[model samples]
Target: MKISRWLVAVIVLMSVSMTASAEYLETKVNFSERLSSSAETLVVLVPADTQELSLSGWSNETAAQINRAMQVREFTGAAKQQLEVIAPMGLSVDRLVLVGVGTPSDLTRIEAEEIGAALANHVNSTKAATVHVDTSLVSDVAENGRISASIAHGVDLRNYRFDRFKSEPEPRPSQSYEWLVVSNSAAEAYYADLQGLANGVFLARELVNLPGSTGYPAAFAEMARAALEPLGIEVTILGPEQVRELGMGSLYGVSQGSQHKAHLLVAHWKGSDDQPIALVGKGNTFDTGGYNLKTSSASILAMTTDKAGAAAVVGTVAALAAERAPINVVAVAPLSHNLISGEAQLPGDVVTAGDGSTIEVANTDAEGRLILADGIWYAREHFNPRVIADIATLTGAKVGALGTEYSAIFSEQEDIIRTLRTAGENTSELVWQLPLGPYRNVTSSRIADRRNTGSPGAQAGALFLQHFAGDTPWVHIDMAGNALIPSASGIHPEGATGYGVRLLTEWVKIYSAE
Candidate 1:
């Protein structure tokens, strides 16, 4: 057989291009005391209130060019604002990026992170293989390398991209980063802790961003076990038979229509002897709305991210365990798929949750609460924990109520509410408290103890789950709109935000300290 030279060349190019997007961007971060001037790219942090650029050591021509560029761009050094001078004459570095840190006194750890993320986004577009960031000018200095570590963590977070399944005309070539920063060993140690958090967030985002065909209930459970068990956490997965035997008919009903069986993944991390904090997540891998099928194209397309809450719970466990936090925590995720089949539960079907509370399936679209009903009940019954927090992408009303800026939080406990708000602020995964009392009676049903859904938006879903939470200090986080972003942001690209993992992990840290 004879082949033309053009055909062989095409084959080689096709093979290389096909495998280009298989790997993710790998970055190696290093910290040192000295700032290197001879580099491919150099990033300098400038405070907003500063009147002059720090060009004391630079050459006369290079400094003039930088000043001219800054003036033309009108760079005021506002927080996260950037001005780039490429290939300045007489300078060893190829690219010089002046990043604004706002006011020296007002710069915060969160702002530092945003700066890092913005920088990562800036560099991700270009082919800057090695970059150097000078953070010595930032006035905010604290122990455990808070500022530097935060910036490093932000860079790692924004560097993530989930384009694994895009095999069309070949995805973008993977870019590796070698991040060199001016700092000490303290920053390195602190970033190790933050690295744990970044790992968990990546895992959560990957899980949620996964397609429904590969992310079914049992597969999701196995992935969770693979991620958590090696970190010294106890991972237990209950199949459909075990779930049915445990009186989790409400959860079982949601999966009856799908070929994939429902699963209950319980992950426990014992860092201390104190009472554990139970996290229950609604793990609906794909919600087709069951008998009441989703009519909207957009709604059906976004159903794959319905497992964001479960992914967050699993990620939180990974984060805590990896960091070796001094807190006892247990994660309970009810995994299922709400698909249409002959055996699917219909409207008005009544099923018993794990806590013996009967629920009427008023709307098959409201399946997240059904699974959480069993999950929350299982967490409370078995662990008898100090507090129970349930997170889910449960309702569309939450999007209408709070929009995408914040997740809706519902709880009667003032202390828990305050703690959650603080954690949200710390992590930038903001939460707004909604009235829990008004929706308590909305889930009333004539046939069963309560209906799956009711009027007044997200609160009703929370109330139905509350029946299973019982008297435990519980907080229901309705992360409907916040789980997935419509477009790429500074911190996260356009996809699953991995919303609750950082919030829950920060909350655990603060609560355990108290």
Candidate 2:
């Protein structure tokens, strides 16, 4: 009997749920004495600028065999370069994979971690059951745990993939493998931190990849509750009435056209007695350009990821809560859709923000900053956080300039900006500082307090959001160009990149670290 369309939909949906809801890989990380002969594969690391291809740690017999293979293959310890070697005789190890670390003098921790990811990808391709990684060449004895943890972080990230919709999926080679780091020092604490951070990253990815029908404002709010409330977070959701009562007109105006009700989701984790750090995210679950309407089908199709900022906030908070780190953090997301409807605000409509500023709607598509204005203001009025950071997939100009490589960070605080940049360097979800000059006049409106999208191009979105951040120490990350990747790279697959989740988590975790 032929399967009906509805049945196929049901089956696919079930598979997707099973795949999407899968727990983040808690890849077991354990220490080893050395690259043992009994291992299925022995991954040997070579430091940069080596004159000879000698196997440093191996005994005479093993070293001689590996030397011959390297002589033939020309294996150098240059970073990201790898070659597989097989010692036909005298070693218990089955295969020898040589990886380069490009000139130890210039190697940073971030580069070390990337080399680790490369090693993981190499082993994953061969489907090795057990791998012994030599970290001696990467760092000295004192830095072994940090280096090993960095490598483990890479290995953990490379293991994530979203492939649930395929009728017949390809086998994942590394799905069942065990990873061992050959460092004398144990890295339990570092691994725990990475696991917590990655948990948030994967959660963000899953939310960004979901379709609009399932990942709408209401559903997104519920998702946050399910993820955060269980981790001892106090999750509060405000509906239209509550939002309207607080005079969040800019937020309510954007969602007036959509059938899905809008909401503001606040998650508070008060691990410290001190004032909290506020994280505000723009949650346009789907952006259809509202009354303005998107011009291209491709752009419209990609609208599902419009809420990536909110997804990141959800993920970062869940991670912070799960780790139970001794830091107070509050994550706020304004969830709704920018869509076409009879009740939708028009192009020239004026809406007042929670802070009592009127915005003339120049473009309905520029709605992310609208809701976020309310969210940031709410965080200020309600929580009175010590610091405020808002993230959004808000503009096309930033993406147009930076592509999907690095996110744009606009902040007046150099110290805060420096902290996030360091996080990007460590995590590889990179960020670049951009200018937010005295261009307030460009966003000015003769009739209203401001125009939704003024002539500042991409910077206008950040400027509009800056109005609500006010005089507080604030950071705004415009992730429009950096939210989704076109293809698989490192830990991210061909969908949502989970751009700012790790960056934000690390940024917030700094307080705890201090």
Top TM-score prediction, candidate number: 1
Candidate 1 local lDDT, 48-73, one digit each (tens): 76666655468878877887888888
Question: TM-score of predicted model 1?
Answer: 0.91
What TM-score does each of the candidates earn? Answer: 0.91, 0.87
Error of 2 at 28 (Å): 4.8
Query: Residue 49's C-alpha lDDT in candidate 2?
Result: 58
State the local distance difference test value for candidate 1: 0.82
Score candidate 2 by TM-score against the native.
0.87
